[model samples]
Target: MKYLSSGTKYDSCNQSAICHAFGPDGRCIQLYKTLLTNYCSGECTYCPNRCERDVTRVSLSPDEITKITWSFYRKNAIEGLFLSSGVIGEPEITSQKQLEVATLLRQQGFKGYIHLRLMPGTPKYILDQIAEVANKFGVNAETTNKSNYSEICPNFDYQNDVLQRLHWTDRIIRKKRKEFRGTNRLVGANDTQFVVGAVNEPDSEIVNTVSEFMKKYSLRRPYFMSFDPVPDTPLSENRPSPLWREQRLYQVSYLLKEYGIKADDFDVVYDEHGFLSNSDPKLELAKANRDMFPVDINSASFSDLIRVPGIGPISADRILRSRPLFEEKELTRMGVVVGRARPFICINGKSQASLSDFLEACS
Candidate 1:
């Protein structure tokens, strides 16, 4: 059993990939990701798999895929299979074929974990059928800005098809959960890779879009792939996003989930130049809005708890709950990093004099 953390980086041939690895009973579960075919018809500027390129593309037959999965499963090499493919031919045809493989796996009694990627432009009925067979389904908006859709994914229409498919998939997942009643297992929903540096869109926009998806569909996970310049892609010459910027986006995303920070609240101003790249977005926000901080930890609401640097919503709640038991001195003594926390939080109505003052005291 292997467990992949949210921030764990996995080394791959062409790029470093990030994924969550779930483990059970002190053992890490094996997660296998493979593409059915690297051949694609869509012309996404940032994708290595886009059509019109002379890359070595391979497509395993359904039987071949099944055999590979069974061989690994029999040895407990993997707990599940994550199958995705570059869109080939019509979306309907490609999607149906992907579904056929998943259905066949289930028919063969291989039901460990099957997660299928739903390509944009897939029919609603086909999506439903895929949902019926798959344990999880995922789709990638790729870019958040609508204008980039044309420059990035030229063949895929953002308005009519892609958005519709996502909404329909959400509806189907909801419907299935309802039909299965309380006993039915929830089907996980995921979004695809965000090409971080391929376009000029700010991190704020990308995170906002993801936040909305999480709120709307209770999406299980949102995978962020920092844009790497793939050889021969239209935007191959484009620089990759600054690593810190990508890291901050992931941090802010965690804040959004753990601290309940709304995307709008942290929406950064670009200055007609570019997104902020100096400090972590949450730290920047906390520094800029000094008035919001030094919140009385003893009485601050859960929402207020998240406004403090280093303190997320959960920690805030823990503070509020533990206030009755621990005094301010005790909390500081309990290794809460009082120096960093002092500027943003108050202890029993007593605010820190200043960041410098708190630092001095802590030092």
Candidate 2:
């Protein structure tokens, strides 16, 4: 279990203030994310344990995982369990092992959040059983589309295995919400991850796919894994994706989610190669659309206020609720990042700082 736990860091669902998983109630949780087994049969080029890799293989029985999860939850060491696994044999067989662990936890009176991984192409019947005990679930798409999956994981089917399962998970979550009102324990479009820079696909395609998923499947958001070559795997020598690229994608995605920034809005954010420059995406967007900046700090709507580089939803709403600002320092009190927002906003129709000054700094 110790070694298996280390491998799960690849999945974005395992985040932190140290394993920080946010519950349905908007509380951050420490999820006991660990692999059910590290043994595998798939031959994916990027995986460390893709059947052919020489690594120590281990499997924890369903009963064993249940004990581990329960012990953690009881002691407040963790608030949840996120059970994922490598394909020990068939995908379905491995999925069953995950379900059994959740079942045992539920039976043990584990009321905390339980996030189980749904293997690609898991049949609807299995989804139903898993949903009964699971508060949330995920299926990593790994990449943007079928063609991309072919390059990195030739044996993995992006459609039947990955996308179809995503479609099903969305439906089940919706159905359960109707059957049991106020019981929608789901978050995300059931959530997914993509290995950014895994292929030569543009950031446009990645963000576009996530936007489409959000619209079509009610995806709350997506997590990105900046590609880092693993030793002894097929991609070991490939250049690792810069951490800034991952950070840029997250900012762009956040804009898409919170500020309703659309794909077309990002056209200038990319270069000739269709990649974002290593810079603040929000500032880039404001710079490109100069007319939109210098928005009246006091009168700007919640939507327009958040469009400013340093002003977020929280500060935007604060500005809205407490209006008619008399001084610039008031902006700071409401949580606005005054330094960044300086060039993009005005108070009492007075520009905070000339836009030319900001542009000069960027150069």
Per-residue lDDT value at 174 in model 2? 85
Q: Rate the local accuracy (lDDT) of all candidates.
A: 0.69, 0.83
Consecutive 10-residue window with the lowest summed lDDT within model 1: 6-15
TM-score, one value per model: 0.83, 0.92
Name the TM-score of candidate 2.
Answer: 0.92
| Residue 87 in model 1: lDDT | 82
Off by over 4 Å in 1: 1-30, 215-220, 268-274, 325-337, 348-350, 355-363
- For model 1, what is the C-alpha lDDT against the true structure? 0.69
- Looking at model 2, how many pairs of residues clash? 3
Q: How many backbone clashes does candidate 1 have?
A: 5
lDDT tens digits, residues 226-268, model 1? 7778788788888887766766777777777777777777754
Q: lDDT tens digits, residues 1-363, model 2?
A: 887987786766643335444657453558888899999888888888788899999888888888888888778778788888888778889888888898988898887778887677677788888888887887888888899998898877998888888888999888877777765454323788889987889998888898988887777768898898888888888988998888899889899998998988898889998899999999999999998878998777888899998999999988998888977799898888988998888887788656576899899
